[model samples]
Target: MTRKKNSGDFLKECMADALFILLRTKSIEEITVSEITALANVSRITYYRNFTSKEKVIEFKLDKLISQWIHEHPRKESASAYESSLSFFQFFYSIHDIVQTLIRANLSVMLLNRLILKFHDFNTPDRNEYYRQIFISFGLCGIILTWMDNGMKESPEQMAETVSRRFFPQPEP
Candidate 1:
């Protein structure tokens, strides 16, 4: 027996597929909600119910990816700064393709700024912590953009190692 499809799930799948197609063919600025709905074979109402705007859809995808990363790499009880950096780099590497597309679409800078602010809000408890978080997030965005601009030649692991050395230098044993 075949299971019935849920309306919400169906709409999400349609949106995902449509976004993938859009990424390949056209700039985000050139795409419209009607076009997305047409490609997804869904009504405009369904699309509106699911997402307020195309940008929201992209935000939702990024948020989901970040949540998955947090789940996959929970902060250890004794997690050091390097471990935290590595965990984030791993997550970034996993979603590199989607990220590259966002970068190509000129959305990465805005997204990165928002993400850094979010991280600062979440991790910073006091004034000092706030500054530290802001600094780290800002620096991380620079490193990530550099990697993307350089065609991502090195593996994420190698990039993480470089970041670790630069930001969280190891002490001589």
Candidate 2:
């Protein structure tokens, strides 16, 4: 038997859809919770129950997308940085539509902030290691933003190879 979505779950999905639809034409700041609820056909109470603000809705959707990617692509036993970077670009390529939309909507910072939070090692007490993780996260975000800005014409494989060559240039024969 198939499980049915609970009311809150259904409402959250509606709100997210409404937000995305509105975002297509309106900036996030211009979107009000009332507008979201009205468009979603949900109640103000329902919106507040699921999200704190309009930005939270975007954050929720971003987290959902990232979670889906992580589930679909399990990490290797000992994946190299290049392998990870390939997967990274591949994931963005798969979601390029939404990525582009977010970029156009000027909400890409939410994506960057989310990435930084995901890469954060709360358990690590070493400052240098923490800094390294932040640096990598920022670097990846920069690459994605640039790619989206440039229309993302290159294939994910090409982007991955370019990044690899940049850091590990081949010596002249």
User: Largest TM-score belongs to which candidate?
Assistant: 2
What TM-scores do the predictions have? Answer: 0.83, 0.85
lDDT of 1: 0.75
lDDT score of model 2?
Answer: 0.83
User: Model 2 — TM-score against the truth?
Assistant: 0.85
- Give the alpha-carbon lDDT of every model: 0.75, 0.83
Candidate 2 lDDT trough over 10 residues, lowest sum: 1-10
**Candidate 2 lDDT tens digits, 1-173:** 12344666667878988999898898988988999999999889989888988888988878878877878888786876578779999889887877787898988999998777664565588888877877777888999889978998898888888887786465779
In terms of lDDT, the best-performing candidate is: 2
User: Residue 38 of candidate 1: its Cα lDDT?
Assistant: 90
